[model samples]
Target: MRNPKKYCEIWKLQKSFPSPKGPAIVVKDFDLFLRDGEFVSLIGHSGCGKSTVLSILAGLTTKTAGSIILADKEVRGAGPDRGVVFQAPCLLPWMSAFDNVMIGVDQVFPSAPRAQRRQIAEHYLELVGLADSVHKMPAELSQGMRQRVGIARAFALSPKMLLLDEPFGMLDSLTRLELQQVLLEVWRERKITALMVTHDVDEALFLSDRIAMMTSGPGANVGDILEVPFARPRDRKAVLEHPDYYRLREHLIGFLEGQDHRKPKPVAAEEPLAISAAVLSPA
Candidate 1:
């Protein structure tokens, strides 16, 4: 958050699980370049290994091949610098929302006294619209509220990078939209480098600076990267009305259709995607 300049580089990343025939590759040659404070979403059909790639970056899964570097350091096992938010809130049922967030703040700020750490937790919890629910236990909160805590905890870390795997996938649509707005508001404060894995096209278009589309698995990889032209302080209504919004949406759907084994592969667009974002931005 201080520098507002963090970089994540993934090169030739691959993950494979042993199979009777041979190694079953889920992700292969997955190269991604994330700029400082940029939000990038990885979207593909379910089971396409988008989460696999994100997990690798989060240091939760071992890569069968390739290298991952963040802040100029190679990613090994899980580290505090990277915060992960999954579909589930993953909170401690016994702890209050505030305590759930405080546990992380305490670990990251061990030198700080309880009062200071409590302040950190309170600030983020309030930011996520959980100010009144800070003292409530996980079971006492709704699913959406629990996720709010997850988001709060992640940002409380002030992590160099954030890895989110379908953080909103399990929520109801209304709750999802509310949390998305909360996420945008909080993220705008620091713009910490973030990578999210989701299949929701509207969700990606509304929130991301760029969208990374993945091919079908086995051996899924980034097939294209679309540069979003909508200006920041994004309004959902304005983004939906943007001239290029549907075009970009169609492009994403087209890519997915092409990768769908159930149908014939889609022919490439007549316009070369490399021309500019007006056409498309291939990765």
Candidate 2:
């Protein structure tokens, strides 16, 4: 791995892309200071450029302006150092859970022996509590199970930074919480630097060392970086009961709600299926 301290030394990064209907997302004068192993979650309305930021970080999309530095190297194109997990699990339906993870290892470490690749995948699956389901196909798994496969795949590569675009966004409430626990376990164990984009205030509070709240659309910029001071091993019950929980949640909600004089679009009787589905499912 490259030197993480050198990665932290640069400042004032920016990115944007042209859209026929104006830029889909624009980040201006953005200054993000990230440490070696910290977890940061980005939160904003749907179109506030959360995923776009992840794309820029992953080197999957080009930045119209500014720059991105990972470890000590400037990101030129998609590199093995950053692993991205999308909102959808995006598993190969034909592949088993274990194979899905092994595929990542194959791509990132093609020279590793087949047995070594299997060992790495199995380790991550066991870490995520999916060892029993290793051989199950995507079709046989629940939404959360599919995402657990995704998580195992991403972590198995041992990426320097894990970029998560609401990886649990499609799971039900119970499944979401269950995966959150699994994620915490993997995150703590690996000490991987992570950046996650999410809409859920509670979920952000649960997983992040800091929550980077963005402004409303068009010219969205980061508004606040709220630090989560609660110590780990953080327990779900204890975190909920922490006196600071409500305060921190309300602060994030207030920023997101107050941005652009917009209220969260109410769940009408007939929204688009994908949008509707995402709202009900937390990830």
Off by over 4 Å in 1: 1-6, 262-283
Off by over 4 Å in 2: 1-13, 19-25, 260-283
Angstrom error of the Cα, residue 98, model 2: value is 1.4
Best-matching candidate per TM-score:
1
lDDT of 1 by residue, 90-183 (tens): 9999999999999899889999988989999999999999999999999999999999999999999989898999999999999999889989
Cα misplacement distance, residue 77 of candidate 2 (Å): 1.7
- Name the lDDT of candidate 2: 0.79
Q: What is residue 184's positional error in candidate 2, in angstroms?
A: 0.2
Candidate topping lDDT = 1
- What digit string (tens of lDDT, one per residue) describes model 2 on residues 186-229? 88888888889999999999998889887654444566789999
Worst 10 residues of 2 by lDDT: 274-283
